[model samples]
Target: MRGFDTILVVDWSAAEGVRRAERDSIWIGAVRDGMAEKPRPMPTRREAETWLADRIGSEIAAGRRVMAAFDFPFGYPAGFAEAVTGASDPLRLWDWLAERIEDDARGRNNRFEVAADLNRLFPGTGPFWGKPHRDRFPDIPYHGRSRDGHGMAEKRACEVASGASSSVWQLFFNPTVGSQALMGLPMLSRLRRIEGLAVWPFEPVDDAPAVLAEIWPGLIEQAVRGREGIRDMQQVARLAWAFSRLSTAELTDMMDVDAPEEGWILGAGHGPRLTELAMTAPDPMADPPPAARAPLEPPPLSNDCFALPPGVHWTPVDEALDLLRARLSPVAGRETVPAVGADGRILAADAVARRANPPGANSAVDGYGFAHEATGAGPQHLPLIAGRAAAGAPLAGAVPRGQAVRILTGALIPEGVDTVVLEEDTRTDGTAIAFNGPVKRGANTRRAGEDVDAGAVLLPAGHALRPADLALLAATGVAEVEVFRRLRVGVLSTGDELGAPGVDPDPAVTYDANRPMLLALAARWGHEPVDLGHCADDRDALRAVLDGAGTDVIVTSGGASAGDEDHVSALLGETGSLAAWRIALKPGRPLALGIWKGRPVFGVPGNPVAAFTCALIFARPALSLLAGGGWRAPLAMTVPAGFAKRKKAGRREFLRARLRDGRAEVFASEGSGRISGLAWAEGFVELPDGPAEIAPGDPVRFLPYAGFGL
Candidate 1:
């Protein structure tokens, strides 16, 4: 009723297995206030569920009412639910499907078999139809037309009103949404159980944290039919934008429905409203909403922002990440810098293309340019024009009939000339040129906006600029960008026995590796490294360094545990802000997370290897948010295991590993004292917090060192 603080539109995929970021995969587009996040392509329903669930929880925690729509009917034909589940309530159908339908990340399911079982229970030919094969499905029909006497309405009342052509009975083929519903309903059932989450039409949604709804993107076909890129992506983006722009009263009317048995689409009877709203969707190329440019300084962390969730003995990787994403707000300040100087800086707002690349139609080769039609059915010859079009120059006038002009790459094609022939393909004399017949039309001609369209969004907010990205920004005529200031990270290492890198240590002591390594890691992540310097394990001394740190956040090694001499953590605990997550990760512990003087402090373990691993795996993402860049999850790939191991649940392990024969080989020793192992391995093989008896061919997640940037 409040028009939702956030709107997410999903185009669910019905693919049987994990898919890539391509067509036929799930795509989600979202709008918050007046800004839109880049569409996300999900490879599996499992991932989509996790992402959707987490986002809902995160939004609710932030006190934002969310409207999440999936492109599938929420209910079947009116009587179908009663006939199948013996209940008129649409939720009953969702529960029944949740219990009967089985789906997995690998894209295998028993939907067809489940449908076959349902058909045998119903009278006559039954309602469900369509599958991947031509082979007969004794109970399920190949086509909806082949079925009869199902004793159920072919389409729901809302479907007919909304002009949604594909009925729930058509499981596949002809732009059908049935399979998506069958696959998505189980996830919906899981979501319905979330606290403060409600289903539209079927459940009253007053002041709910989030509302789940069935949306037919085709309700406003004109809005998405002509957009570029993937159709599914465009549909969700424009639709979400349109929905987010609606007024409270308008949204109320759309939601004022009573189709408990046949759940209504959000905008089923408001087609004109949808069309009208689509006409005014925000332009991508234009400057985003002012809110998109976050304030130069971020607000302080909310109460209990760093407090760990209770009832968890060991924090898992996913829980840690979700907590970071939900609670940690960016603390970095903002600035506008020249595009060239914006290297490695996270965008404070989206950077749009000021102009298209290859601003005009130009020649792509140094050859003859003329009307493609001039090349008749046979080998043709034409007189060379007096003028030439070279790179950075243009021909004065259109080429005359039966004439061709010499054109070099990057030169604008003259009027009336739409094609070019490579010099090697043509026999050119001093005054004329001859080429073969049947030349491809518009060949070797670079059209305007071929690489990038004018006003297109070049980079989304929070994207860190890379060297290659600068080329794109420059090509698109972006002069300067709004970026977050580099975070000032201070590193403090304790223990009088430790010495600096170049200095020799005492007989019983080793040179301090954690401090320098942590500082360098912070620098590599585009932060301003501040050396807090080493100090002995005096709580008063540590407190003094932290008080005068004057940095955005601080990182400390050693003395983080709860032992008597663990001053770093003791100081934080005294301040009532310490949360030793005691995370269940190898080489990770007492991830001393706390806020001191309004700045986050990370106190890692003493062991060099443990400090490095914990900093990379746990502190990296948290620090990213503290720096005003959004949480960044390290990229990981699945590779076969080159070694065998038996592990118990409760602890996640990250083994220093390298890729060999396309498999991940862990370091020789699992010992945390082996600091040399960190340098020996190229990446880390992460084991989940589940009992795993891994063998040689088993798959494991490999996180490359390069993926972390730092």
Candidate 2:
């Protein structure tokens, strides 16, 4: 067997509409080696198809062996397919159903109808039934029950063997899994047709880059019961863990199981082995394979490459940003808000100009308005008109011939008058005005629609509104604007060595500084931060809090590094999912990213300085993405290095610094635990990746704390 590189577990769904990482919707869990990568969600089956196609292509191109598992059964009971579709072979049946199933991206699916249609070929009621809420699929009966001498309710061999699993024919009762099967098998059929991918048990697994298989989460779920956190997430994690830890002999034995028509579950009869392996396995990050441990070239941007070997797991900052981009997308909900109250909100749609800036031509200054060519030469005078045009009050009648109107600043220009002469340049009498200075055409005259035109986009979507943007909105005369809702962030602090400040502390415990700092930072960014309190270095307590934290994203400050007291990473790998990112950056080195209860969670180091640095450098941009603005690199400017210092190579460093005498100055201390360094420093002086000698007057990149929304 090829060294398995990637394992993808998809908990398929028959429900309509895009859904969050909750129950009954699509949650795709993937792992490289033993580490769980980010699981992508698909609102509709069509999106899953498109995403899987691209992902499979990318994985194959990267020379990786991939195993993808879907939760639904791949085949029906032995002879029932032949009775209905006249096909004895399951692949033929797959094709027959794939061509007839109707589903769309708009949450419209004919799963019940397809089931009814297939049941029409059978004798009495059905092997599949369950009337939908609307359009009650009337061609066939809408219910199914096992009756004496009935052939339709026959159970598949696998379903009978796995006592906890649901039967394929029970579409309506007892867990209602038939809908997933009816809707899922057709998609798998389409996937099997792709080149370089093989379907398990049916297709012989050779050197194909990816192998598709059927999985029943129950087989392993029973062995790993009584665990906290989300059941579905744990099941997926266990599946990935069990599959990755399988020895070559055990994997071959699983593949060689005998199943004529019905498919065997991937981990059947190996529950004890999988559970033991999951419980007693050594740390996956302890010792990596030679390929993973080998020093390779710097990783390309994530947009250019998606997956890499586990040994060389530490991603460059640029590549990490790219991977974050791949993991996050803008939220989809939009709301109409009053322009007056929309300040500090992100625009969901483009704000267009309702009308032109100036309704008509107006005077630019307080002066006499007259036709430019009416005065032929200098020192010429014209008769003053009786009516005057002032701001907000325009003269109604047209200008008389050989006459000039007294117009004030911002007043509309009189009809047939195209120029304004300043009062300082002309002497005015009671009845006539004298012009002495050189007069030119269109002097000091404002044109209509100069500032803005109707129907033009004044501000595009994804723009964060500022005070100036509100003024622009008011000028555009737009009463209401569409904007994205603010993101809800949950802040958690972990470790038995932490407690609230000002409280009596244990002899060995310190104050909890990271949570308060994170919460304050999130609030400063105009986001809603929910306090998730604190958790000790215990998995059960952490799991309880994680299962109940309902925010859009989670930020934790501790238990991320690979230490014995680091229970967060270990628990995350067991319950939900986790990916350890050994980022090549100073101050913040160990970063953990994963999904818990369907929401994104970020785990930073325990040190206050390191936690603060990681939150600003990584979490802020991720929050921006969740707020629908997408990711933005920290704003950096080149400034002169105020102090000289020698630095090492390999990792990039962000030293606490402030501008002094027009040059950036570094703080004296470089320790990550120094909280005073953050308070005293105004910004950071960023060092490059490689070693270099910095002297006075050398240019260095400066990143202000304000740029990170501090």
Say which candidate scores most in lDDT. Answer: 1
| Cα displacement (Å) at residue 53, model 1 | 22
Model 2, 365-452: lDDT tens digits are: 9989988767776578899989799999999998876789999999999887999999888888768899874688889888776666
> Any idea what lDDT model 2 has?
0.74
Q: After the best TM-score superposition of candidate 2, give how far the Cα of residue 352 lies from its true spot, in angstroms.
A: 1.1
TM-score of each: 0.69, 0.56
Please list the residue runs of candidate 1 whose C-alpha ends up more than 4 Å from where it truly belongs after superposition. Answer: 1-153, 156-214, 217-288, 291-293, 310-312, 501-505
Q: What is the lDDT of residue 92 in candidate 2?
A: 76
User: Which candidate has the highest TM-score of all?
Assistant: 1
